[model samples]
Target: MVLAMRHGAHLIWVGLLLCCMVDMGATMEFTGAEGQWARFPMWNACCESEMSFNMKTKSSHGLLVYFDDEGFCDFLELLIHNGKLSLRFSIFCAEPATVLTNTAVNDSQWHAVTIWRNFKNTTLMVDNEVKWVEVKSKRRDMTVFSHLFLGGIPPELRSVALRLTSAVVKDHVPFTGWITDIKVNNTESALLNSAGVINDLCGAAANMCLNGGVCNVINDEPTCDCSQTDYQGKDCSEGKISGFSFGPLSVLLTISNSSPLTKQQHDMIIYRFPSFQAVLVVQQFTENADILFL
Candidate 1:
C-alpha cells in the first residue's frame, strides 16, 4: 500500500510539472522577414475557418495576412488593406463582403486580431474591442478548397518570382512583423511550432488574475473571476457594491447627513400586496446624505 501511494503521488507531481512547463511555453515567435510564412494544410482550414492571432509589427504599412487562396479575391480571408484591418468573405466571384475597422492598424505595436463566422455574420475582434456584422450575401460551400497561406502569399514559380504582372500578387503582400499566439476555431494550430515560439499568450504565464481572483482561458480568451465578493471588474480591478444587506423578510438601511447646517429630507416608501405577497420599495434621498442599506 505504501509503494502504491508513493507511485501515485509521483505520477501526480510529474503531471503538474508537465502542465506548468506547457503553460510557461505557450507563445510562439514569428520572424516575418525573408519571405517567411506559416503554412496550414487544406484539411486544417476547410469550411468556415476562424482565425485569431497576436502580432507586433516592425513596420507600419505592411500587410498582416491570414489567408491567400486562388480563384477568389476575398472569400474567407482576413488582411490589412490600405492600413485598415479588413475581414472579407466572397463566394464564386460574387461581391465580397468585408468588415473593416474604423481605425488604422499600422501603428507598429502588438495587437490581437480575431475573425470568425456565425451563419452569415462575421465577427472581428481587436484586443478587447469587437465588431459583428451580418453578410448580406448567402453562404457558399468552401469545403472543396485546399491549403491556406498565413503571413505571406505563395510566390509564383517557387523561385525567382516575376515582377507584378497580376493584380492578385500585388494585393497579397506579406506581413513584416512578429506574430505569436495563433488559434483556429478556438484550437491551437500546429504551424506555430517554430523554434523559440511559445504556445499561449503572456497572461498564461503570470499575473492574469488580480485581487486573488482565478484566471481562466475560455475559447482562447483570458478571463478573471474575482475572488472577493466585494470585488469586480475584468481583472478584479474594480470594487463591487457592498451597501445593502437583506434578510429573508427584512431589509436594513442607514443614512447620514453630509453637512450639519444643511436640511436633508429622505423618504423610503414600501408598497405591499397581501393578495399577491409582493412588496415594492421606492427610495428618495438627498444628495447631502449618505445612505447604506444592509
Candidate 2:
C-alpha cells in the first residue's frame, strides 16, 4: 500500500511539471533580425476597435506593429523611435496623423501598451501615460486590408511599394524584444503565424532573474548580470563564490554541467575575469560534480 501511494504521488508531480512547461511557452521572443515578423488575422479597426499587448525591449528603434490596405487607402503603424513610442495612421491617404508618447519604453522593462480607436479620434496609452490624436482627413474610419504584422513585415513585401502603403515602415528597423498577452477588442485569443520568433520564455518576467539579480536585454537577448550579487551564473541561481587570485599565467576553470553558457554570459565572464585565459563552466545540478582548474 505504501509503494502504490508513493507511485501515485510521483505521477502527480510529473504532471504538474509538464503543465508548468506548457504555460511558459505563451510568451513570444522576437529576434529583431531583418525580415523577422509575425502575422495575425486582419484587424477590423474600421470604425472602433481596441488593441493591447505587453512588451519588453531595449531597442531604441523598431517597428512594433503595422497594418494597411495594400498601399491604396489607409494604414496604421506603431513604432519605437529614440526610446519613445510613436503612432502614425492615415485615412483616405490624407496627411498622416502622428501621436508620440513622452514615456520611454526601451528600458528593458515590461510595459502594458493599449491603443483605442474611435473613428477619427485615437488614444495611445503606455502604462499610466496616455496620448491622443485625431485624423484630419474627411474619412474618419481606417481601412486595413492587410493582415496585422508584428515585430516587422514580410520580406517579400519590402520591395513591393503597393503592398506596403507606408513607405517609411519599409525602412523602419524590425522589433527585437518580447511580446505577449496580445488582445484585440478585449479578446485574448487570436490566430498568430510567426517567422523568426521563439514562442518560449526568455527572461520575459521579472521573476526569471533569481537572487535579486537584474535582467537586461542586449542585442535582443535577455541576460542577467550577477556582478552585484555573490552568486555567479546565468540566472544567478548557482552557488556563491568567494575570492579569486590572479597568477602569473592564465587559469582555466571547468565544471561538468548540463546547459552551455550563452554568448552574452560568456562575454560577461570574460570581462569580469580578464586575467583568466578562459572559463568553461557546464551548468547542472549534481552532488558529486567535478571541478577542474588548470
Candidate 3:
C-alpha cells in the first residue's frame, strides 16, 4: 500500500520526536566572580542545568523583594518595562496567583527556567513553555518543594550571592548564567509538588511559605496568615513522606517460644483443644496459642 503509507509516516515522525524528549533535570551550578552571586532555596533544590545573564539597565531594575509581613510572597518581577519584557506574577499570598509580563527576553543568549509541579498545580517555565501558574486551595503540604532564591534577595546581611563583576565593563561576561535541567513534575497532580520549604529562622535562613494563618514574625519576613487548614507554606520539603497499608500475608514471624499459662492452666489448654482454638482475647490477659500437628 505505497510502502505501507511511507512506513506509517515514518512511525509518526519517530513518535513525535520521542515526545519532545522530556528532560527536566539540573542540579545547580554557578560560577560568578567579581562580586559573586548565587542563591537557590526551593527546598532540597539542586536545579541549575542551564544559565545566562547580562545587565545594562538604563533605568528600572530592582528585585529585592522581602515580605516579612505582607504575604507569602510570589511577587515575580523581571523588567525592561516600557521597552518590554516586564514580567510580574504576584499573589499577595491570596487567590489564583498573578502574572504580568512585558515580553521579549532572549537577551544575548541562553535562557531557561522551569519550576513545574504536580498533585494539583504550580508551573513556571520559560523555554519548555508555561510561564505562570499557582491555583491552590487546600493543598500546600504535599511537598515536592519550591523555595528558590538566586543571585540576590531574601538576604538579610549577605548570602544569595551577587557582586556582579563589580559592574562589569571589560569584554562583558557580567552574569553569564548557567542553570540546567531542573525538574519537578508530580506526574501531574501531587498538588503540583507542593510549593514549600522552611529552614532555621530565628537564627535566620529565611524562605518559608504558607499564607493564611500562623507562621508569623511580621517585620522580618515570615508573614503568612493565610487562614489555615493545617498548611501554611514553605515546609513541604518532599512532604515529610508517608504511605502504608500492606497485607498479603504480612509476615514478621518470630515468637518461636513463649510461655505463661495459668488461669486454670489457660482453661485446660482451651478446654483441651477446642477444635484448634481461635478464641480471641487481647488486652486484659493477652493470649494466643496455636498448635497443629495433624
Q: In model 1, where do residues sit more than 4 Å from their true spots?
A: 1-34, 43-49, 66-74, 134-141, 156-169, 192-294
User: At residue 277, what lDDT does model 2 achieve?
Assistant: 58
Where model 3 places Cα greater than 4 Å from the true spot, the runs are 1-4, 7-13, 23-85, 88-294
- The whole-model C-alpha lDDT of candidate 3 against the native structure comes to 0.32
Model 2, residue 91: distance off in Å is: 0.4
Order of quality (lDDT) = 2, 1, 3
Q: Tens digits of per-residue lDDT for model 1 on 1-294? A: 999999999999999997774454244444444444445544333345577777765444444544434444334656676766777665444465778786566677768888765545668888777887665655543322434456654444134333222234345556666665556776765552121122254246458556666543444455665644446777665554445567876565543222233337334434344545656454445655444332
Worst 10 residues of 2 by lDDT: 266-275
**Which is the winner by lDDT between candidate 2 and candidate 3?**
2
Where's the lowest-lDDT run of ten residues in candidate 1? 192-201
Name the top lDDT candidate.
2
TM-score of each: 0.47, 0.60, 0.19
Best by TM-score: 2
User: What TM-score does candidate 2 get on C-alpha atoms?
Assistant: 0.60
For each candidate in the order shown, give its overall lDDT on alpha carbons.
0.54, 0.78, 0.32
lDDT of 3 by residue, 1-294 (tens): 999999999999998876563332322222333322233323321221212222322223323111111123333333333322333333333443434443334353445444433323334445445554454545442221233333232222233123211111122221223333333333211111111222122115233432223333333344443333333234422111122344553312222222345566532222233445444433232356433221
- Give the distance in Å from residue 112's predicted Cα in candidate 2 to where it truly belongs: 0.2
